[model samples]
Target: MKKNINITEEDRKIAAFAALAIVIHVLESSFPSPFPGIKPGLANIITLLVLFRYGWRFAAWVSLLRVTAGSLLLGTFMSPTFFLSLSGALASLLAMLLLWSSIRPWVGMAGISILASISHVMAQLLVAWWLFIPHRGILALTPILIATGIFFGLFNAIIASSIEKRLTDTV
Candidate 1:
């Protein structure tokens, strides 16, 4: 007797989105950073759009898959980089899920994006402080990181909003 896996169209859709996120992640990794400890994270724009258009589960799957697969592609699996990526993604997903479930009616994509961005940045900073740097000096960078998070969060939301509008119009 054969068992059915119950893979539905939704699974395929999630896979496609995850693949896109993975590609963006890998491509972004190739870019030269102006300095260390700062990434604009444009790939997160895709995850935010998916979260609003689809659901938290799909977004979570795409995000984690992208982190794992992208790390493997970049040869950072099981490394410090991989842990940072995992931590950030998990934190972002948690923030999104909480906001989406509780205040979705009152919150727009911008709010979600901003909150998720903050959560991601904070998670990464904490992880770096705990696992990598482990110094009081690391706390000094919190303000800079928070400012960057706010800027990129708003920027990414604007882009995601336009992309969502276009996608909605085409469909």
Candidate 2:
């Protein structure tokens, strides 16, 4: 029989990844945003990292923790914002899986990050349009939000790519 190690390398990787995700989420949330939902998406870097290093399962865990803890700490618990964030996070994770599968490993981090960010923004907008605000004013912000989404998405992609390069060589 094979002996089971009490602390596996994979366990350490998972804990480190989750902690990094939470820290990034908190940092991003702390910074002031011009708009309600816009952030540098620093946390998504961890998602991309996990997707690249471990797999989709780890990536999904990162996303789930990021959103759940983010909402609770930001005091958006049980609100429409919570639901919207949850939807966006899940959509982003799904997009990451899709992009990761389709792209090469060399650029997988950037591709997955960008696609996930776009997916998250779209999900948030859809949730806002349908559930919270159905007014013209809310819809009017779509173009601006979309533009910001692209900008922040690309920013996160670059960061994720950098992190992937830096860490992959070491780990």
Candidate 3:
């Protein structure tokens, strides 16, 4: 049985954005991290931009697609690493949804980004501790992870905002 699926312009936009994010994810994965579980998460900039421009739904699609596809490409699918990535992405998406629904007008990109990033790190750490490590020492990385989340979140926000401005100006 074959069913025809109608693809809308919005669907195309989401695919395009997701592809961009996937590329960034793959590239970032190739870089050497200073720590075992730390990266700048440059791909998240695309997710943040899509969120601000197209709304949370589109951003969610792009982000999830990026994680799934990137994991497959990296040969990490169905691995613990994949689960960790999915958990972090899901956590980040939830944070974005909460902010977008409740205090969107009051919060700016920086606040949203920081909160989402922190949520991502926390979710990953929890998953790692519960599923894999099962050690109290895993939680010891909390402070460092949170601090990096704040720094990278703000950094990504600044870049996202700049890109948004350019996009708006050109439009």
Candidate 4:
């Protein structure tokens, strides 16, 4: 017998969030960065918001969808960029899951966002070093990347929090 899976309205909501994330990702990609690997990661704001509002599952769906669809849309599917994006999303998801599951009551959006952001950057850096560069020089960028992650993570968390407040007010 074939097992049936039920799709609910929540699935549609998650898909909508994922689409928004993908759009944001693509738009962010259009801008030129003065340096490589210095993106603000604003698209992650949607994921962080969804995680705070819905749950980790919804947030994971949105984040992974954004990375996969965004990579495909950018014509980077199965390329180095795709791998890096996937690694970062997966790492961030893992970090968020751990933090949200254990210390959720104690920690807030800023804490989770900062940890996830650092995890994402670390994963991407490791992937880049292992797959592309394969040199000790890759380690030199760790401090800079981590600092950027912290800054952007806080910034994105603030944006997400503001959006959430507005949404709650309307509802």
Best by lDDT: 3
lDDT of 1 by residue, 10-102 (tens): 888888888888898999898898857778888899899889888999899999989999999999999999999899999999999999999
Residue pairs with backbone atoms closer than 3 Å in model 2 (clashes): none
Q: Choose 2 or 4, whichever is better by TM-score.
A: 4
Error of 1 at 95 (Å): 0.8
* lDDT score for residue 89 of model 2: 91
TM-scores for the candidates: 0.94, 0.83, 0.97, 0.94
Each model's C-alpha lDDT? 0.90, 0.78, 0.95, 0.93
Could you say which candidate leads in TM-score?
3
Q: In model 2, which regions exceed 4 Å deviation?
A: 1-9, 103-107, 168-171
Q: Regarding lDDT, does 2 or 3 come out ahead?
A: 3
- Total backbone collisions, model 3: 0
RMSD of each: 1.6, 3.8, 1.3, 2.2
- Pairing residues by index, what is the TM-score of model 4? 0.94
- lDDT for model 2: 0.78
State the weakest 10-residue window (summed lDDT) of model 3: 162-171
Clash count list over all predictions: 0, 0, 0, 0
Per-residue lDDT of model 4, residues 49-151, tens digit only: 9999899999999999999889989999999999999999999999999999998999988999999999999999999999999999998999999999999
